[model samples]
Target: MSDTPIEFKDFIRIIGRGQRAGRTLTMLEAEQAMSMIINGQATAEQKGAFLMLLRVREETPEELTGFSQAFRAHTPTSITELSVDLDMGCYAGKRRHLPWFLLAVMLLAKNGKRVFLHGTHEPDSKRLYLKEVLPQIGFEVAQTPDQAKVALDTLGFAYMDLKHINPQLDGIIQLREQFGLRSCANTLARMLNPSNAAHSLQGIFHRKIDVKHRETAALLNDANVLCFRGEGGEVEFNPLRDVTLHLSRSAQQSSEEVKATCETFITKPQELDAKQLISIWNGELDDTYANYGVVGTLSLMLVLVDKLDWNVAYQQAQQMWQGRDKTWPVALPKYNLAAETFDTTGKHYAH
Candidate 1:
């Protein structure tokens, strides 16, 4: 076998240069790089250089596939027979307020679907993150691959940490601070699908990046991929506008075939105040935001699994949100000020 350590150094050398000299890494090469990243073979300087080079030039579909392959090889996969393996990793890291993915996951999971939410707590701009909000919402954050699997089977919502899933890649979290801007790995990290899910719902920030995300999804052999630029890159529901969705299916299937098999909907943002939004998130509002796009996304999953009609899928989502006010428990655990006080920078929290 090729010496693993030397292989990583060579991989770094290829990516460290500003120019792309060697051939685009094959799936195995990509996997090896990911192994190095997760295993911590690449030094901080090497990591920064590699990420900057890739970000400036962007990665080809093959390179993205390789990176993804490496990511999955190192990270543990949480398997569940649920029809859709939804990954909500929108880039607007943590914002100034509560996380929308937390609410969306709760709503989706309450309806008998399996959801995989993976992210890190590296705070930039603000400290709000799913890691903090999920536990408050009664979902346990898994600290290990085995724990993540058990959580997926039992709770239907599994929050996988990058540090836990892929430690080498996780090591780069602090490096971004030194560079003062995000690198290619930030985007690639979001695209990592360890579950090897056939279907995915990924939120991208920039329209240009969305294009790359779609292309990469195709390269990864995803059966169905929904890529969109959400408000502030927070995959949170915006009831006012239809969260734009770009649908892509594998090359093996015609676009017409996939389009014919899918369902689509348009929704307006439900009027809600900050407190009302939080309440709605906590399943407290009688009719906060219908969260139309989220519903539509789930409906699409239903169509994939059962071949359900669009109307049926829509109704299924409608029914879930209809009486949500009454079904959700009114008494939820209060947010601990002590916990929320810690900022993402590891500094004192201020709100």
Candidate 2:
């Protein structure tokens, strides 16, 4: 209750008050608060304080749903016309290993699933991003919604950077560097599901965040939402670690703990090479550990996509991997022969 006009500070006060008296924002309040920030109505100080306060506390499902709703309201609705079957969010870059979940995405695409992948061009220098790896693996990143439509229509998969999808949200996401810590922007971005897809896959770095995402999915009445603790917080499951999946399907929330498929941990390579993505897909690299990561993630996605039993899904994923077209993009109908090798600099360089 400051003497000055209420404005955004009202939200700041609600969440920033002493822990004893502080309260979570209701869905409508959170939505309105986020709308103010997104519409540039909140001052820089108010924005920083609001984000940091939410970051320090575990954001409630209502707050997440509200924030995401505000963001989705501003994004383009054109992608919905394409009827993307799966919505995958990638924000956290990989540090421990290559993003094996990407292989799972490609596998789904190869099997005729329309997938829309969205992520920020994260500024983290220590990690590997999808934008960087996609090109190295012979896939180009989409710069706009129209380009994404083309990719999805032709390849059954597309990765659009968050900046293009919603620049205001991406700007807030980039504030992580300035704050020296991640804020709720990252979590809210993952929850956008701009395409209004029936299924969504999200990876969380913290278990508490997983709960928030699960509960939020239920509140949003999402058809199928899967949240898991992914490798380096990217949506790729680590088969070596037992994974607890938080799911919200048909507006009901539940959880499942899938046992690790193996006991041995793969040794981290000294230098990261993304080109191995293609080699492994081509059957030139027989990497047991990498294969496990891919199959493990694919099985989890099957649970999301088809509602299959975990064990049965694992078996089916193995079979799918084994039967995969080794020649890959060459066999793909829209994969251009000239753009066989995409460069990391966002340029298409011919072989």
Question: How well does each candidate superpose onto the true structure, as a TM-score?
Answer: 0.72, 0.91
Checking candidate 1 for backbone clashes, the offending pairs are: 31-70, 37-168, 38-168, 239-268, 239-269, 240-269
Reference-based lDDT, each prediction: 0.57, 0.82
Candidate 1: list runs displaced more than 4 Å. Answer: 1-33, 36-41, 77-85, 94-97, 241-244, 252-278, 281-315, 329-351
Candidate 2 lDDT, 140-245, residue by residue in tens: 7898788888898888899988888889999998886688777788888888888889899999887677888899999989899999988778888787788889
Q: Which number leads on lDDT?
A: 2
Candidate 1 residue-wise lDDT, 144-237, digit = tens: 7677667767766677677776666655654665765565566666777555566566666665666777777777777776666554465543
Residue 72 lDDT (model 1): 64
Off by over 4 Å in 2: 1-6, 330-351
